[model samples]
Target: MEQNKEMTAQESLQLISESFNKSRKDILRGSAKYFMLWGALLTVTSLAIYLLWHFTGKPQWNFLWFAMPAIGYPLAALMGKYDEALPQNEVSKMLTGVWRVFGAFAITLSAIAVFLVPMHVTLIIVIIMGLAECMSGVLLKNWPIIIGGFLLGVGGAVFAMLVKNDAQLLIFTLGGVLLLITGLVMKLQYK
Candidate 1:
């Protein structure tokens, strides 16, 4: 009877662990898509901004960043539709809250950057993104995201200090590449 009780307990623990893992993976996979989308958008925009400024000497072209919202909003909404359609358990609900807070913080930081130091906005944004990624990684117990986030934060700071003028292009490009790589790693490893 004691042995049967022990076996049952072990089985319950195993099942709990498996459920937790599945929930975590589902959340991470959803997040990976966002990371990849943003990564590609940033990469392309950075290259375009660099080329436009380098060739045409038009500083106003920086306004191209405004397009991000136009593109990102729809994509995010579409993604959210799928997520909302799925039934969320308590763990998933908590994970969703975590990401919601992260998004709010990022948007607030961007708003602040727009007013304070517009010139350094790209680097600042990259650093913020890195921190958010690090937080997500820690929460999910995903090493690739943590490492990528650390690299992006450090790289953005270094680029800011060294590049001086027209640094956004480089910083954004590096951030994009890091995010893309991390997303891809998470997708492959988790799935």
Candidate 2:
């Protein structure tokens, strides 16, 4: 028991130390894709909001953000098709756990809102953001993706109360801001 505890402590200390004292290659390689992703995400999402808001005027169907995957992701996949991804199965498994719990809870909340809220906004955004969360969960192995799922569910419920078009627009705009803010926070923390 003493040996096990000692080794565990040593492992924990090593992890903490390595995080702060990473190599230049480690730091750059670590943040390169992550920062680029955030840069692309925010840029594309902002553009999508602009285009969707301008063309459709149907902010409810904010489906154009998927275009990022169509353009940006495909390009990256093409670029990295030859390279190998890092071997981090354990972290990925842990991340999947977080995403699963959050996903289930968020979906449950959205389901409840659908039955009780008497509005569709909550349901719609939940579906959209829910898909995003799932993709992040499955692809990126980032646990923070769960927050987006939670926001989508909760934001939808809050949006239900807004009855007028102007008010609805405000609510949706705020929802977009909320997503952007959450993404920025994750970028700052994780980067």
Candidate 3:
């Protein structure tokens, strides 16, 4: 039989703190792969869309942007499955919640841009992506991610504004490169 010992408040708080720290480290370790994965997909898709739109002279090729999520979600799901052994914690839950909300916002805004509005959807999406990444960095206490998000969000937006027509798609490529570097930094640092 095990004896039950009551923990003091200080000891309980310490245990909670330890758990949170451990959860954070685990989440950060796994997040690098996701950054790289999405970054690669975004880069490739942007290039493809750019080439198709350029050579074919069809602006409708812009719809190919949707392929990023189509490919990324399944791969991410597989990665998440592999990581299922790790216990769920508050940090993980919050990060997932943040991304889910961002995804919804992106999809909704893209749809609205395609169907109703004549706004700069690429600029808006890049900003949202950067905000989401920066929020994740804030939660994970990662500087590289924070800096990357700021560059992709602000710099990319400015670049998008300056470039014309098909050139705007290249902004996604720049954002993708930033994300890829951020992920590499995280992988090396965490390892």
The candidates, ranked best first by lDDT, are 3, 1, 2
Per-model RMSD to reference:
4.8, 9.2, 3.8
lDDT of each: 0.71, 0.50, 0.81
What tens-digit string does per-residue lDDT give for candidate 2 at 1-191? 24455557788899668755454223323323532553455455555565566676665444444454466556656655655554334433444454446445544554565457644544464455555554554444546656655565566545656453323434444444544554465445445
Q: In terms of lDDT, which candidate is stronger, 1 or 3? A: 3
The runs of at least 3 residues in candidate 1 whose Cα sits more than 4 Å from the true structure, single-residue gaps closed, are 1-16, 82-84, 87-119
Q: Each model's TM-score, in the order given?
A: 0.75, 0.40, 0.80
Q: Could you say which candidate leads in lDDT?
A: 3
Candidate 1, residue 109: how far the Cα is off, in Å: 5.8
Model 1 C-alpha lDDT per residue in residues 1-191, reported as the tens digit of each score: 24455557788899789988887677666667767877788788878888888788886776676676668779878888876454555544654566567556656666676667455665667677778667756765778778877877877777776775555577778777876876787688779
Better of 1 and 3 by TM-score: 3
Worst 10 residues of 2 by lDDT: 23-32
As a whole number from 0 to 100, the lDDT of residue 83 in candidate 1 is: 67
What candidate 3 gets wrong by more than 4 Å, as runs, is: 1-24
Worst 10 residues of 3 by lDDT: 83-92
Residue pairs whose backbone atoms clash in candidate 3: none
